[model samples]
Target chain A: MKIDTEKLLMIPGPTMVPAEVLNAMALPIIGHRTGEFGELLVDTTEKMKKVFQTKNDTFIITGSGTAAMDMAILNVIDKGDKVLNIVNGNFGDRFAKITLAYKGESIKLENEWGDMAEPEAVKEILDKHDDIKAVTIVHNETSTGARNPIKDIGEIVKDYDALYIVDTVSSLGGDYVDVDKFNIDICVTGSQKCLAAPPGLSAITVSEKAWEVIEKTEKKSLYLDLEEYKKKYNEKKQTPYTPAVSLIYALNVALDLVLEEGLENRFKRHEKLAKATTAGLEAMGIELFAKERARSVTVTSAYLPKGVKDKEFRGLLSKKYNVVIAGGQAHLTGKIFRIGHMGTAKEIHILATLGAIEMALKELGVKVENGVEVAEEILMG
Target chain B: MKIDTEKLLMIPGPTMVPAEVLNAMALPIIGHRTGEFGELLVDTTEKMKKVFQTKNDTFIITGSGTAAMDMAILNVIDKGDKVLNIVNGNFGDRFAKITLAYKGESIKLENEWGDMAEPEAVKEILDKHDDIKAVTIVHNETSTGARNPIKDIGEIVKDYDALYIVDTVSSLGGDYVDVDKFNIDICVTGSQKCLAAPPGLSAITVSEKAWEVIEKTEKKSLYLDLEEYKKKYNEKKQTPYTPAVSLIYALNVALDLVLEEGLENRFKRHEKLAKATTAGLEAMGIELFAKERARSVTVTSAYLPKGVKDKEFRGLLSKKYNVVIAGGQAHLTGKIFRIGHMGTAKEIHILATLGAIEMALKELGVKVENGVEVAEEILMG
Candidate 1:
């Protein structure tokens, strides 16, 4: 299992793909136009809708979660259409950029990098921009380990005449997104993040409200044409072009596993693991990352001892101790490492990742007051 | 495996994934930031370049072939830039649209849908458009079952300054594409066609000249940014965003198998099998969809008998024989049915597919000879 002298991935997605899912993908190839492929497509779609917690239209495309984020804009925003994007982390900025790709006239309702969007910021944007065609935000920001106030923001957007797009890339399976209660027009997620499969596709649940707006879009699109794909998908389970069939097979199995676990239990397990890990990190004197309000249970970003950059220290963990942790991206690079507790990760896995970090920190000669002692206290004793 | 009562895929892409490739993908997950993930990334890219027939910098992304095709344009094309494109099938039309998606202008020089791109037609376009920034062509048009005169076209392009971009999504591993000698600036391909991995990633090799042009591209991008990816990828084998890791693992194994068979042997096997299949179809009075000038060896498009429409015939094949073939796409819908000879396909598979078609045609009461007799005579003789 150690690929080329490397350790296992205990982090969130690309989570370890199960043998059954991979075995399912290994089944003989079927023509995408054939009945067998169509049934597989239909089965996967039906199961995905259940996971989305919606009776609405659900579909998939052969791309990463980022592609789903991109499509949310392609389907809803017109060229030069004003979009109100709430930025909390890298993903939120990307949502805004996707709107920009299609020439969307957009405004980023700013916040401290790790701060979740407040109802007041969204209300202020909606009140000011009468021309705004859509309100976009991330349901969970994995970069800084923050979950936004999506339900609260959803209530604020309901009064406005604009589409609401939410990126649930890292949170959909680990937590309940409640797309209906959140009034989300487009809720997107990827299988690799929390569904425990290989990465290749993005599943997006679209509302009738969003579909109506997309029908009138003037963008010269062929691939990301939501209405076109929807029409063809309805006639048959076939996609407009060749789809990732094996990924779909893997998706079907992964969704079954998720449902078997039950959404409430899944969310609770993630919460417990996150709380336990955070408590351990704190006891070791490592502080949790900034989040003005809400945060996700899937991951926690923590600052290393002052002046002990994550770049050198993290490399040592992977190279010496066989553990992997994400360095702070962009401005936060070299400042912290992110611990993921999503998908199939367990309490033991969390502790193992932490222990490696403690070992790496100790070798780096950083200020530490018996780090493993506190971590073991919460995780074991 | 009869999913949703739909037939299995036997057409060009989304081919049956081999168990070894799937098992390779099922390896335990590794953290994306750790050296383990980075090492895999590096090794995967190295093997991918070999599959692409180029030593130029290659990159992997989580998307279908279209995604890679579009990325080729995004990095190299600017708004209003003119591109000379040769359209022979459904995929060629997609390339044209992809160019337009980035607001780049396309000067299309096309043959009939089921015909090859004549070398003279390409030369004529090259001579006419001095402003053409690049010349794009599909190596194999799956819908048409035709291969363009790439070698001849390559000689022609080398005479001009236009960057030659090739879409070898179906042809790369099954057939030989000499990127260096063919003067290809950007060569793009997907995993499922002949590589025999699951459908999830699209890879591309970029020559230095193409990189220079990409450097000049000022179009705003994030996820699909080629320059940024190349920089980070060279320094450390990591993508800007989380990669399709499982698909990459599958691709690595698929590439190994492709190389094990040896590229020359693979090409020759495809050529021999293609001839036998075509001879069988012809003996049964089924006309070839591809022209005589350049027929692809990986897929065969057969004109259905007088009374048969695509959907009805394919359905009967699935229900009765468990055989699958693709229907015509775009304006050619119902005109021809395509049988893919790529991926884990060998002589026996092709023989069975052809035999099933004959049975299906007979079931539909078409006037024809015995399919098995004709096929057996061609292959065993």
Candidate 2:
């Protein structure tokens, strides 16, 4: 199957990588055990720390973001340890499920699908369960397109002695995350999301406090061992196993682009795109699924129009307009559609995506007009 | 630490990828959930079955060969299941470690590092432990360059009720292994080795009986679950998690190359290179590490000259001659070196590699001569 290479990809993760990063990946692959790859690994780790906004040691593991999330849970918490899991969406609930899978006791504080994780609810739970060993939360819920109040949650957790672990799989480079200031013990981000590289590598940062806990626990898994990574990074700046070398090369180029654009400007770009896309959808008489304050900057989620079918509308956009967007996951499927604006997308691309949606809506007999103009107005301002 | 990109990669895994395969990987990234990617995944799976010599389900997982090795064990064998692990070298030992990590009871059948797993030895162990749930072995041990008699071992294993799983990580596409005829229940291979793709993906073929065992077992992992892959493949031909899309594209092209060359011809090519390499090393008065009958066709292992240091000799080849070979791993480190002649390397490349070693040995005052001539004589015949 030949890919439509010219299509504008607007998925939530695996967002469009720039030509420069793609070119970097096309370069010849070096041996992973060689000094050349070791140097690249070290340089990528240093740059990843800048992107993660932490002074902690950063390591890249050869798997998806879920691997990093699993490692974070399996390494720190032993069986039967009490973990306060904040669940607002699919990813948040996944943390709770992973805790259960590893035989940990999870005290779940679940909110509605589109609701942001509230600090007061978390504080109330922590007040009741003082034996909580770790507080697990998703900073940005990918399934519902809601940005939880992790800074406030982090502040509340610091009052207690629970280790704060955050999954920023959909945020990191596109959104602002101060890992050190937020008192986060473990932070996880994926390569395909805001990093704008290909999928397969996950970057993680571990604070000193988390390492102490990890040092005391036996390894639950040989594949996702944190101590193995720590030993390899400290001694040789190499991974314990063979890594995805070409993906690392792409990530190095992607991180350089992130630094070149400056973090604040990149965050502003994501915010602007989110606002423009949301305004365009609202002008078409559609309501956003996420609450106003909790709307994610990387992707904008909205309810489908009364007459439009989710699959048909998405098919028309992809086949005819060459604009591929993401559908809702889990329970939100067919109820909502997501417009991703993370990494490498600009004002013009956002306008084009809105125009394609408008055309698809017209074809589906939904009364909508001037969507591109609405988006352009917000983007220009 | 920029790589000498022009150098020939002669390592066991991550061998030289053909230009066509490299170009396929350079293609633009596509969404994992897209129909385009689904078609590619389906096509690749079908072609992988042909290469694996199996009629069972083949899965493309987004990790190293070790992930496939890990999955083969984690999926079928539950905790406390008795497994007879045949230990010939490092990878064979790793399979036992994985079994123990997952709380399984393992009975090890030991052999020396550079020796093959004898069929008689395996039969003896199985007779003693008739209650063994599974038998794990490696077709080709990458570290020791020893190819075990898996076909013979498989004949002995068919008498028992134990499931037979084999790791063909370094030998799948380049060597001969009839998965069905050998009674192999599960076989694991990597894209980077004899398949001639970049390192990131592992393909595994599972028989119907193995799937029955997997269906009855509870999920031990979310990532490496074979049932999850089977469910996704049957329903929509999609991976349950985000995959390395670019690597899969490369694998598709590499498999096409393998089929075009014909399986028998590819196996003959590997055998020819192995013979030529062995003839060249012997002419230089170097002894092969592995026994004569057990030497691997993909990589040739030889003891380093008495007066020459492994590092200095390998460094001279890489730095001056632009030919990168592999040093010994684990217990054999500094004692032996390896030369790989797997996928995409031709007879001329083998002669060139032998010439590089000859020049390097002369620089190290080893007095080795006519290495390239000896290799050419064998290749011509």
Candidate 3:
């Protein structure tokens, strides 16, 4: 409702939020301890359970996606516990780092960026390490635009004694993720990513198994302790601390849109968009950075065209066309750029992004052709 | 702009936000890594320095007031260090608890809930315990509606080797606190408080002295680590993690309003309103909970009328009059109620709140007279 319609936001997370969701967030401040706020929070949690596709207890944290990951790890694992971290990208490695921060021993099952973690590899590690307390994995790796095989790995983890933790920060709403079916003990996602809400809130669902682990572990950080969160939520349907009330309102509205569209349909729409985006970039003679079968539906990663500098190309899109996209992170920086197509994004948005890229590349004297047409063809099909 | 203005929000922290701030938040989110967002963040930090009254590095975090306090402690103290905690209310005690959670020893100088922490007492403790690494104090205690003597304590702490950490969650924008003059090493506040912005974001100012300690301490949390925050901020003027962009945008606008009004005028306005509220309640034959000189300008804590039921009185105000007020917490529940008049709250709003309370009390068979008239008279002056 208050958005500047001129500039289009296409970042992976902090994706383009719908006007309806923005309007919901724009609603006035409510007392966090009031019955009205409690009722609102309870209702929103119920809706979030449906989005998460889980019967487990869901709680909201007033922080970024990384904070959710911290909660999932810090609550379940105690100091000196051995945790298996499956790393394919930046966020996965962050899981190991967080575990280490909590004094847990992180045994990382490493994979290359833009590659998926194999179920067999995870099975081998779990079989070898019977004392592992928990296993952390990223469902969708935004850093390299890769989607890990969470369901396959979840099936393997279900048979093990270790608690299964999944980070679905970039995929939850846009991709197919049934938390219960995936045998997830703790599933984490952020409001800014596929939920089409602003950043600063993370939605996390916890299973009974995770709670058992949490009960045994000492509270690590006061603000992030999940036991405190659960107790406060169960008693009064309120968070242990003050939450981002406006963002919660926005998330509820965004979840309404997701449910209205239907989860399966939303997943299919994202899949189609991902396909179109990949096909268009390929048609433009640009190579996608992600390996086949591991690419993400929410974001598409690709190498920059020859002669087109990363900054110059991105600047052209932002400054000239009023379209903004993200560049690569960490080791991939300057070599690639990523275009996000999640949460309120449509075929037109995808086509427009490609068209702008095509024009920008031409201005830079890079040889590229029919990017928009190729994207439109794929989207139509 | 989307608020149900009929139901006034008169609560400490998550205070009523202005229409302009809300509208600014509702605007479309931009990429966090974009030049535009970086410029916005830099400009906001500059404006925030004016509010904080310091040349220190101020970083915005995505969490409540407690998280900022957690950051202040976790980043400065290592394991097995001694810290002095000044406890007057719930939040002050929480600082000690956090210090203990990090394995630091906390020596508490306790005060009654409604009483203020004495600077001389702190100096005595410092005199006794020269090994104390840091001293944590609360500028405004929301639970008891009391304001501590931060400037006085700051003067004492400046002579010592300990870091002076102040929690200004409920007082920052409404009260006078010069961080530089007060020798505050780490000063923290939340967006939902007197800033008149939404929750889920905290603005914390870290002095060079505090940073020196943080540099030596091992990282406690990946999410709340100020050292990581400073590095990323210094490199690109961006947070290490994705921030609540909408809330930041809203905070920038809210800070604009605060600066436009002038800090001195804002503090005077809060003082006058606080006096009016207290006078009006006393005129209605209700007693104020906070001590005379230590009363908070943002919130007023008061004893319920003899025959009035806490739930029944509050229920009538919400259901019948469409107004909301807060009841006391922990041991003070059912004994007192709190009325918040911070951020975007005007004299007319205070008059309306008192009028509603007067009407509710009358319905409950409590004889009350001239409550609104008294408030109006004080406000008129």
> Each candidate's lDDT (Cα)?
0.79, 0.87, 0.89
How does chain A of every candidate compare to the true chain A by TM-score?
0.95, 0.98, 0.98
Candidate 2 lDDT, A1-381, residue by residue in tens: 476799989889788888777766666767888887789999999999999889997889888888888888988888799999899888888889888878899999988888788899999999998899899999888888899988888989989888999999999999999999999999998999988888888978999999989998766667777888889878877898778887888889899999999999999999999999998888877788999989999988999988678899899999999999999988888999988889878998898999899888988988886778888888988
Q: How do the residues A100-161 of candidate 3 rate in per-residue lDDT, one tens digit apiece?
A: 88889999999989989999999999989899999999998999999999999999999988
Task: Tell me the tens digit of each residue's lDDT in model 1 across B32-62.
Answer: 6666678878888887877777789899877
Candidates 1 and 2, the one with greater DockQ:
2
**lDDT string, candidate 3, B177-283, tens digits:** 89999999999999888889888888899998888888899877899988788888889888888899988889889899999999999999999999999999999
**Every model's TM-score:** 0.92, 0.98, 0.98
The DockQ figures for the candidates are 0.47, 0.62, 0.64
RMSD of each: 3.0, 1.4, 1.7
Give the DockQ of candidate 1.
0.47
Best by lDDT: 3
**Ordering by lDDT:** 3, 2, 1
DockQ-sorted candidate list, best first: 3, 2, 1
- Which candidate number would show the highest DockQ if scored against the true structure? 3
Second chain alone, TM-score for each candidate: 0.95, 0.98, 0.98
Measured with C-alpha atoms, the lDDT of residue B308 in candidate 2 is 83
lDDT of 1 by residue, A123-144 (tens): 9879987988998898778878
Expressed between 0 and 1, the share of native interface contacts present in candidate 1 is 0.50
